[model samples]
Target: MKKTDVDVVVLGTGNAALCAAIAAKEQGASVCMLERAPKSKRGGNSYFTDGAIRCAYGRFQDLRAVLPDLDEEQIQQISMPDYGEEAFMADLLRLTDGQTDQKLANQLVSRSFDTIQWMMKQGVQFTVNENQYYEKDGKRQFWGGLPLKTKNKGVGLVQALFQRAEALGIDIKYDAKTTALKQEDQLKKLIVEIAGEPVEITANAVIFACGGFEANANMRKTHLGNEWEKAVVRGTAFNTGEGLTLALKAGAVRYGQWDGCHAHTTDYHAPKTGDFNKPGDIYKKSSYPLGLIVNVKGERFVDEGADFRNYTYAKYGKETLKQPEQKAFQLFDAQVSPNLRKEYHLPEATCYKADSVEELAEKMDVCPESLANTIRAYNQAVQPGPYNPAIKDGKCTKGVCPPKSNWALTFEKAPFYAFPVTCGITFTFGGIHVSPESEILGDDKRPIAGLFAAGEMVGGLFYHNYPGGSGLMAGAVFGRLAGEQAATFCNRTKPLSSKS
Candidate 1:
């Protein structure tokens, strides 16, 4: 019903979209952002995350540049290892099993720390992650790779970006869903739904950063195979693939793994869609690395300790989906019970406790006989070694199928706990193909003029899995690039003003 024009229009309001808008505005382009969610739930997948962004750092000083609040005591308390761009690249390629695009991976790693510093200039604040690391014998140690996160978690991350964008005069429209896109020569048009009514927006250039199609059950069942509809959506319900779909309709090339996604071990009782009230990844159950996980048949399906939790957690949910009835349970003994993440303690969490393995299985409705045999075999196979949670201790099972390759310990301690778990789809890896400059390419493998993409919507950076904390990093890196490029494109081609 209403028509408006801007120099640049950014789709979505998460980290990627916000970064794109900020960069475009800095380039002297009048920017407007379109968000599908309501004002109260504006942030997309970025709001549901822990706000961890993997960055390449050469020393403590490099970290201090972004996290200025690191006191001498806090610095002395932790072991800060130098994580270079080479290490970051290796991690990306290794986690994705060499399926990540080399160019995209290079850009993500090289720009990671610098992007965080740039975000700091834009009022985004970060701190060393306490959740991913631990303190032992007065020496704090980092685990699951290099770590940095927003000071107030996901909420703070988005709020900081929002503050910067607002300060820069970016117009953001919430409850505006982009339904269709049309090209009128040099100008790009977007038809959006606002309060159940259609409104047309025209822009010189567009940056698509809305995210993937993880929330669409139909898309999931189609691309991700059968029973994927049962996977719990771990982020915004609004990211149902319109961005990727409309872009493809307008000649964007589809790339990356059509069946691949990033998932997490979420509580089995989590809602079908992400709970807006529980905004900060509270539904995730990350304690499986310190324990054993089994299906309803009481059998370990995958190696729980194949790698650090950061690398393995993203793919474990898929293995969970393949289990019987798409359900599994994590069992932890009293010795390692206190080491679980903060989410396990939430009042809404579904957990059962018992003094024995059979009792625990009974409470969780698992086969008691099979669970007892599995536990007995696991305990018998655990070879003794120095148990270090900060690194791969190689305390492993000697003769078990799908052995616990690290942090292996007997489950003989009393007061055992079991938590039911299911797959929580974070974001799909199938997305639009883009050039090194973040320009979305068409099926002919050429960049489409006046169009760019960032975040999860621009795939080829991941495949079957991804390393934890890297999602936000990739989002920031490509978001900045796409924004800068879109701004340049818009300036090169002047479109008619809406006021005309």
Candidate 2:
């Protein structure tokens, strides 16, 4: 049996948790961070992230002098076009159906730049680039997304944050799981858990920075649906949604539960054989456009040939629920093979070559006769169809764009490749309810005593869709807010009488 005490107890050693600990310690609070996974890998999901905390608004006006490549106008475009207090509020309302806590959402987005600069002051590396046509004004900006390329200094920005957290003397505990809530007088108190034996830690605040549930199959099935449960766990392996479940069990409300893990096309089976091939993540250029995406009944759904700004795999997930199996196909002709094989090696790309469409359909596991007939009709389309008369229209699941727009290959060009694609989830958008000051809000809409929450556990923080890399950005921003707010809360108010 062992016991420890601190002003704040943070769960997880990931970026969110680490950032919270770093911020808390800097704010003159004794901080301790816990990790449920192995410390060697730095808690999977966050460690492998593309590592750029996407922050919009306010360009680095002075940096342009040294880096001539990035200009002021180009930087502005990279940020979300609809940025403001109103945009933040509206986004939460639209996505959460007016259930989001508007105050907290505004706080997180407003303080994003401060969090970024704080990380920089702590010796974190970053790159400044002008994202031409990325958003409004094309203003020059910093590399909030590309952390690995910073002056060739580090592998990831979050990785550098981890190093900085360690240097700041924040207690980093690995393989520690917070199992129960230590409630005093019906108010949330310190986190209680057992590592190897009996252990308890006393703290004025506990932050659930542990990631959302995208890895645990049962949790995924329960939340997303039975079929989607089998989806390949794409986020961090350590993110099994412990905070989500634990908070709910403790009467915590939820937000952004509907916002799911989204992805586009990535061929797992076919990889390039060159020395320059690199593993991809949220940043890599997708190997789409080279394939014709089709729905279950051997039908073209979207326009299939358009720019995919936010085209995600979640679109397909919605369709898979209505179809026989969670499935979709990318059809490509010989002309596309070189671009895919030579340029971007698609994983698990299946090649089907036959004299007739029916034979190719048979090899692809699609409706052999139905697919053949559909192809024949499509080839003869006079009025032009996603233009076939047969087969039910495709289930254009995730994208807001036309499906067939990105899908080409008329099947008139024989010898095709059909790669099966899936809609896998990554991180969950739902989280613990809070106010901007990192104060946890109860059902009564008041602060939950001295308790607080931020990071992935932030409920009602996001309005509608995520604004690019705002997840990590918000984590750093709000985590800092929580630490400082909690510190101020403790400073202004006298210590409680042995409650927690």
Candidate 3:
């Protein structure tokens, strides 16, 4: 096998891996990044995202630090209330049912914006997320806790990071799949395959940012329980738990919820894995809050208007998965169809429209009588209140079973719309344990020397639920920490002699 040596090796080429490489290089360490995919498909799950980042900003000054290009007109156009660290931490703990690891949550919340600033210093660009808020009388009113995204979304994020890495002289090897790892005295050797040829790479420190096991079918069945065989993968198909398995084999302690993951309602026709050709979050059906979601039986199984779509979308996917055949449908009337996100109008969407409820049900292959009864009861129960899509307008159902707590508009308009949906597993929550500095922890509760982890594979940041846009934020925060700590360790350790 061809053998080479480096100071630090970062596995995976996603946002976290790229951030780790950039941070390590910034800290004066010679870094090499290995991507399982070819050059054309380098970035992992980060490439499939919408590139929104949930950050805690006290005011416009905080946003101005990272987004220095924001003009006065842009700043005055939007109303972004203060999303402070305390509020961020509360949301994390609340969404996870207080199951979030306090240490990790604190770190994630405190360092959220600083990491973005760090990325900005490395030539990353940002823009205000205009879609995050609704316009009222030509005034932008923000609702969700996030209002920032990479310019041009995830494609732009990966391209910018890759370009920055290249400018910094970092060695990024595409088509290099690190399959196995072995210890030879003080050196860690990674067994990688490039063009069907096995090679060995020895490094002083290693950082695993390869993501979670969401793409692995058997692992999904084992960890996330049954009926996951049909769950659509929302990111790169190359992520099959290789790095996670390697870490486990190396005696790293498995941490967090083994059966928990981040899932959301997606188009039933979406591919088994995310399609890079599409390149955006078009497959996601996030407008359920503006309407109602029903199972194949034409029954409302979940509280569609429980909260803002951003906060509740993650957990609803599990509910969708539990439905018969792992399928559900989101129904919207003409009254609320105008509020649907842009993705709803995409050509690839599987949407059915009819002038009446029964006709819509017949077209959707649902029992017409059951759907009519459900909608009739739902409309009657809706409380009379002002309808506002931007906030919790309190236009709720008064006497309905599985109540719609907010945005409960009556389905009185014709040309009702319905979209078939299924569960799309974005990332798994189970992962290896890590220290405050992002060092991978062994079973003995001690830091594994020369080992680090970040991204979705670093557990305890989430449990049964997650907030939207926080995935990318967590990756950057921990990726930066892992890179900094790994570089410092590489600087102190001596090169391992060839004792194997």
Model 2 lDDT per residue over 1-500, tens place: 47666667777766667677778778777677778765654544555444434543433453333234555564544332323445444443554456556666666666765666677676666554222122213432222122112222223655677778778888877777777776564233444444555476766666777877767778767766677666655445677888777766665676655445443333323221101123224222234444556666787654444432222333443443344565666666665555452223433334456666677677767788777665555544423325211112232323323334333444556566666655545566666677777777777767766676767777665433444455667777877777777666555543232335
lDDT string for model 1 (340-363, tens) is: 988899997999999888889899
lDDT of 2: 0.55
Clashing residue pairs for model 3 = none
Worst 10 residues of 1 by lDDT: 491-500
TM-scores for all predictions: 0.98, 0.72, 0.97
Off by over 4 Å in 2: 58-101, 127-155, 185-195, 249-251, 256-291, 302-307, 311-314, 317-323, 332-363, 367-417, 461-467, 493-500
RMSD of 3: 1.8
Q: Candidate 3 residues 6-95, lDDT tens each?
A: 889999999999999999988888888998889888799999998889988768667877777778887778776788898898889889
Cα error, residue 236 of model 1, in Å, equals 0.6
User: Candidate 1: lDDT of 141?
Assistant: 82
